[model samples]
Target: MLHLGKPLVVAIDGPSGSGKSSVSREVARRLGLAYLDTGAMYRALTWHCVSHRIALDDAVAVEAASRALDLELSLSPDQEYVRVAGQDVTDDIREPAISSAVSAVATTLGARTQLVRRQQETIVRAGRRIVVEGRDITTVVAPAAEVRLLLTASEEARMARRGIQLGGSQSQEQLAVQVLHRDAKDSTVVEFQRAADGVLTVDSSHMDFEQTVMAVVHAVLDAVGGHRKNG
Candidate 1:
């Protein structure tokens, strides 16, 4: 087992379909750390707004909704659930409707601010030993984390993986919109496609799930080793 003496915050940023969520969850499970899917937070907020008939374009209303959102999400990798105001919306947030509209909420500066603050609080609540994965987790949410990584993949690979994830229901065009177009819109707000300073990049274009997980695990260990040497 890999354990850092102090709190460990592993922040991972990645584009859509890069497997950040699954890989981060598995990494946390293996390391016995808390797991946080920050993207799901955004998705939950999006679902909340949509369910209430709030206009996505109305930034003010959206921000207000974000502030008032009563969200409960699973912190354990062994369990997965997301609730909004005590209502289970774990699977609803993953719906295509929420995916298509989440960027609007994510790009809203005010809403993002609120959610980022909530995420930071969650980190502190988790004893600061957690694996957090999202679009701007490394840059914005946990910039001072012990381990920061940007997981990326080729567009072709990402599209294929997303298609598989959606169970082949979405057409190629739909996948393009969800994977490529969504990334393009979200990029306007955060630079997740590239790695920031001191952030390692893992191109999982050719690696399988296990390979990618091992690569991230190795990166964590390497970072720990470097920290020991510097200390």
Candidate 2:
């Protein structure tokens, strides 16, 4: 799938806390390609709806908000950000409030369709050579990508990593709801926990961060025959 004299596109799908975002960013940096965090796009929309007092269950209103959302995401690995309505919301979208409500916005088929259209546009605008990572990237967003991978970890590992990131602020029960329950809800919309046909799986259950990064890097290199400093 290597295009002659063009950048390579990499698509990664995984459950939450599977390290797909970090690994995809690192791989894009090493490959000198742009990195697109599709999940952040959803989070930004969720934030907008909540801030505007739009009820997520109102599918029509949510879809309208999605259509009107002035969202922009930077694909640069070193300078990633999300902007909405000319406001910088790079960090706000990661707040716990947004995390808890994002699925409500995401599971709406109308909202998901709007976001998926925008995502495809972003990929095309990148000349089809950016590394895009999210829940459904490999299966729905970029199935034709040069390199497609599903990064996964055991539930225990996922919960542990998320717990460390949350800094023990949430109890185990809360963490389970955030990790497992959220995955269960989101899975109803898109298949993420399993590898799709032609997509490689990278299990990082026992691997450290650096190891996971290398695993993805190797997968991309093996699929597209690209050379990198670390490779």
Cand. 2 Cα-lDDT: 0.89
Report the Cα lDDT for residue 118, model 2.
94
Residues 1-26 of candidate 1 have per-residue lDDT tens digits of: 35555789999999999999999999
- Report how far residue 206 has shifted in candidate 1, in Å: 0.2
Which prediction has the highest TM-score against the true structure? Answer: 1
Candidate 1 displacement at residue 180 in angstroms = 0.4
Each candidate's root-mean-square deviation in Å?
A: 3.1, 2.0
The Cα local distance difference test for each model comes to 0.93, 0.89
Model 2 off-target regions past 4 Å?
1-5, 227-231
